[model samples]
Target: MIKFANYKKLYLIPKAQGLGLSKKLMETALSFAFEHYEQCYLETMHELKAACILYEKFGFTLLNEPLPATKAGKFNEEIVPLEDVNGETITSDEINQTESTIEDLATLKTIFKEDGTVTAGNASALSDGGSALILMSESYAKEHGYTILATVGQHAEIGCDPLYMGYAPFYAVESLLNKTGKTIQDIDLVEMTEAFSAQSIPVKKNLNIPDEKFNIYGGAIALGHPLGSTGSRLVTTLAHALKQEDKQTGIATACIGGGLGIALMIEKGVGL
Candidate 1:
């Protein structure tokens, strides 16, 4: 028999209420459940309306005592604003480009497949941008008196069924971890391209990546996916993110057309 636990008496201090800490806590709890249990349950008083709503938002359905196990289906909808290393929002004008603004949830319309959950509001935007990075050997950099941000580590690529191409990242990343003799726990951060909600959600679940360690910034769905430059773009962003967050290791992975996925790991430079 599957067993579930009731997480109660979980309350945030007054000062922490409005900072989205509740959602983060909930995400952390659910992530643990997803990793260890086939199903998870929680019981909360109805008086906590906001908490109830948050539970429902994470795919919990009300039941008498314990809620049934439900997978979180909402991804790509929460578009984090673009922030710099110092955590300041970067305005479009500052970059000489206009960022796409998301429409209000109520007014957003779904396109493509009939009765489809994928909508214009939730899908990745076709973007136009260029990203570049300079790579040099550690010895060469030190000899040249240049600062090193990070060092590229292992890389892995794998193929999967084209029809379920979105899942390519899971296989690719798994292979990468095995090749590097590391597990998901070793990764400090991850930059998995959000080609669509359909794929990103499942991959995240399978990998059991903690909410805090996943994309801290917005993803392709919000930042826009520049096809040709996306790989470089993800790596560039990952490198900066590692340095900014003072993290040691990170992986950048993306699903390619025709059923291929690739993952690359990078370690923060030493003494930098």
Candidate 2:
């Protein structure tokens, strides 16, 4: 679900977990997402510390807030510690001045608990998959009838103990509001990947976005994870839904492998 308007960076790396799959995906995706903006943004998990180190190379940093990704240890035991996921220690120093937050680690742990705060019910379903999308400017959208969802607002990445890898959405959403002139109250809907139920519930409660504003259609838990594609998938899904329903301002984000996350906000077209 990774959608980059006016950029062509949708590359699929089969069985990519072994050979820096996350890095390659972002390298291409960023090239695409940023082609239209002055800057680029993304997120990840502490569980995938290796990927975290690499993204810093491209100016990807932690923001004052975190992106969203719920936990899934309750429904399944698929999740592991951030260190276990990377097989190496990733100190914050290595991440440098990258954007991130404090709640990230607590949220990371919640993603892998059998009865943790974050559970599979709300988090995204883990599986092997990839996705891509193309967003266009208003002028271009009008020319092509590209359905306008929410506008890409702000994004950030954060880290923590692998256990709570699900709380990133809090920061990611907060930053989006700060960047644009909006708040959770202004957001009409959201398409958060179902990494865990805890991830979404807490974020909704904290941000005051309301349950109705989140994943109306089936999320990753019901559909499928498709890893690399989840971020872009959320973006496109939100936009498509907003346009179809004639709403304004939708947000999307996904929990990444390396203790991080990615996010975007789209402003719906006026009175459709």
Candidate 3:
């Protein structure tokens, strides 16, 4: 199937910006995309006004609404119930209250070796919870005449420095790409755990993943993380995001404690 463009994050050094350099970069990237595909697609946030203008100048039309992924009537609008680590029903007020403001985040204590960036407010909160999913064989699923929403593509686990455990997802993504023979350019959506702003931010910078595709919706930084269920939660979120975004193929990755990283590549599921 023909897919979307790989262009997203474009950057120029601070001193070199606003010299038409951004447009030059987009031209080069779009030139590459044109060579490989008939059409190119990109997404940007409202804050990137300049970039959005540049995209529009290049003939990228802005859509008024999100495209639907499934042939089913429309995107699922189910309201998911949320609970905190304490098993108490979490209200929207509680979620809003937990939002870390710049001042609140600044006041948080740095826990990881005094790194000022790894603050309690920026890192995911500790919580008690778990998640479970039933994985049936493809053959079994077909025999039961069940509709499939997605299928597993690839998975990888890797180890990294214990002291810098947050970099685990980087290595995991590397290993996963190696296994699938696909570049980061092939990924449409990504669900990287907000283990800490310190960890997630740098990795994204190093990889050049666009802010739009990395986590369009709020993540653990906004929602509290439940230890064992965090990965599963990411998977669930990615699945729905793919459907909502009307795209296929995504990566869900997490940095684990004790120097480990895990990643899974999943596509939107389809009926047999």
Candidate 4:
């Protein structure tokens, strides 16, 4: 019998928005979850529409009312990842992870996957939320006892085919590279929103970014994307990731609806 699962606090930095790393991470996590458990549940504020959407995308449904048994309790056994529904884990060493198909959607129609490249599973959820940071001069930060995590070196925005909105990040990154006089090889981490895996996948290929160099933690697809706030979210995620991984530089980029893209280059600051 299938059981229930829960996903707790998940986030990313601003510089890494629009890259589908979140979904990738979620896939691995979910595969592991289903292998050991059954249903996976995530809780989020109603205002965080994108996250809620992501939950639904992953075969989760919203309850009209709160659970009657809300008391927390302990579990007897620890869960572990062993295999998926098919008795096979999606891993390169054993088996390839094929793109999710209509069969994956028990109820919802497959959106953007046919000719589009983005399926309901691979696309970002519509979200509502915000994130921010306090920016000040080095003198002020030092005087005020503020610890800087990263320094913004460059920013770029560009326009592209409106119909093919996913590719917008490509041009933005291209422009930022030109302006900063740095190539993609110089970047250590990237936060790209999984706005649509269809779009994000192409962006990764075009930029020639190795899978390991991008969204090592995950992207918006699984984490939930808050529209206006995602830019700041990526930056914050990147900052923390740099400190945790002891890396030097990273970039956060996103593709906006209506033919637009945004990218930011950041360098790691002092310890943390």
Candidate 5:
């Protein structure tokens, strides 16, 4: 198993379902991780249950656990205000108490059913985008011209709420820390999407993470959510920004519909 250290995540991609490409990609990623690091790492959603299952067969474990309350508090402060498509402000309190059902998210976008809590404010903003990253052995990085970004420290995934389709990040975060044998004090900031404040708010309240360490930049609510692409973008931006800021450890998280959530831990230097 290649762990993330000098070895970096070169690229993370998801092929269209039944395209016969995902399996091939997984094989390549595992081979890379095995040859480079202690364990191979990547994250995905339940929408791709098949992909998740394949990774598990290769030894990737599903992340499942709750974060410490103290960490959650610290993370919440990072959340910036969100605005609806109408440009009206969206509040977290409004999201938790929302009546938006999971079914609304299945086929609806922008328009919410009558009395829909999925109003443009409380749902994931849909958009289309893709991203990629390149990682190499630390020696290779220095030998080449790669400016080393944050190294992969640890990662986790989980299924928190199957119905509301949120609350999974908290579990994923906890699982990652547990696997890495770490705690919140070791993390500097958290990069997470505002798919809904319901999940985001619980993250802070549950983990007790300070607000400043959570969202330095605005989230999906304000910038617009990009569905399947959100996690990749979040992790990419975290790596680039952490390297630019010379920060130590940072965590990027995403909660998808159908009770799926993913978390990634990165450090200034590749870790053991």
Candidate 6:
């Protein structure tokens, strides 16, 4: 289930005031809230009605209403191209991958729920592949002259109802943000496993991640989901993606079977 949080006030340090930091801070905080929380409450005095206008401009509404409704097709259309792009980069001979054309997906038959959008065209393919990571402590890396692309930041796991398994990433990411004292605005890129279009769409919407910053190289739906290697694949791709984009921070998350979700934060190494 989705959750909510409230921010009753926002204060700026004396030295940081009057330099237009409040707007930036408020935007960052609100964007994070909208992404990670189901609802957000902001309390301000009547004298601050002008401030309320700012909040409304950022998508705040009376009684914490939900965001506008979105159709599954909108997400499907957007996702298919990303998957095709990612598919082009795969060179492993062990795995057989195929591009998902929008025209094909539009005509494919649903295989999951009756009349549902879930279909063979948009689901992750069962495949064979292997992935591994060599992890070392920061001190050890420095001592050994290792080239660090990124450092692990925070990790979180959460449990949810099995019926909504795909949404597990939302909760897991929320927990990671809270633990690290970070916000979605702080994340420069995200690599979420696209087990299915139906699952990935909701998670992306709830997280409020931008198209340019999420799964830029496509995802499991197109690249094929080698279940045992998916996690390592995500981590490996995320590290390369961050460096390629010249970004400093990223998160990789996925929903697991049996009502569980997982997320890990990564930050680029200093001076690299």
Quote the positional error of residue 9 for candidate 4 in Å.
26
Q: Count the clashes in each prediction.
A: 0, 65, 2, 30, 31, 0
* Model 5: residues with Cα > 4 Å off, grouped in runs: 1-110, 269-272
Candidate 2's error at 99, in angstroms? 41
Residues 1-272, candidate 5, lDDT per residue (tens digit)? 11212323322233222222223323443233222111111121233222422322211110111122212332233234556456677433221222333343334443323533233443334433345666678889888867666677668888753543455777888999899888988888788876544345546667877756766544555345543467767877676556545777899987665567789998776654
Q: Which wins on lDDT, candidate 3 or candidate 4?
A: 4
lDDT of 6: 0.59
Query: Which one wins by lDDT: 2 or 4?
Result: 4
lDDT of 6 at 125: 56
**What lDDT tens digits, residue by residue, belong to model 3 across residues 1-272?**
00112433322233222222223432442234222101111111122222322322211111111222212322233234565445666323122232233545446565434533344454455443345555777889899998666778779999864555666788898899899998888888888886545456555656667767886555565455664677877887788788778878899998765567899999988521
Q: Encode model 1's per-residue lDDT on 1-272: one tens digit a residue.
A: 00112433322332222222223333442234222111111110121112322322222111110111111212212223455546567333121122322224324554443543444444555443556788888899999999887899889999975555567888999999999899999999999887555566667777988877776565666556655777887887778778767899999999876567999999888532
Q: What residue pairs are clashing in model 3?
A: 149-269, 150-269
Model 3 is weakest, by summed lDDT over 10 consecutive residues, at: 36-45
TM-score of 2: 0.50
Candidate 2 displacement at residue 32 in angstroms: 26
The candidate, 2 or 3, that scores higher on TM-score is 3
Stretches > 4 Å off in candidate 2: 1-124, 140-151, 158-163, 270-272
What TM-score, computed on C-alpha atoms, does each candidate reach?
Answer: 0.63, 0.50, 0.62, 0.59, 0.56, 0.63
TM-score of candidate 6 on Cα atoms, chains taken together: 0.63
- List pairs with backbone clashes in candidate 6: none
Candidate 5 structure, TM-score to reference: 0.56
Q: Pick the candidate with the highest lDDT.
A: 6
Runs in model 3 with CA error above 4 Å?
1-93, 97-101, 107-117
Could you give the candidate ranking by lDDT, starting with the highest?
A: 6, 1, 4, 3, 5, 2
For model 5 the local lDDT of residue 101 reads 33
lDDT of 4 by residue, 1-272 (tens): 01112323333333223323334434542233222101111111121223433434432211110121111111101112345445565221111123333345444555523332233455555443446776777778889989876787789999864554557788999999999889999889998876554455557767999867777655666455655667888888787677667889899998776567899988888421
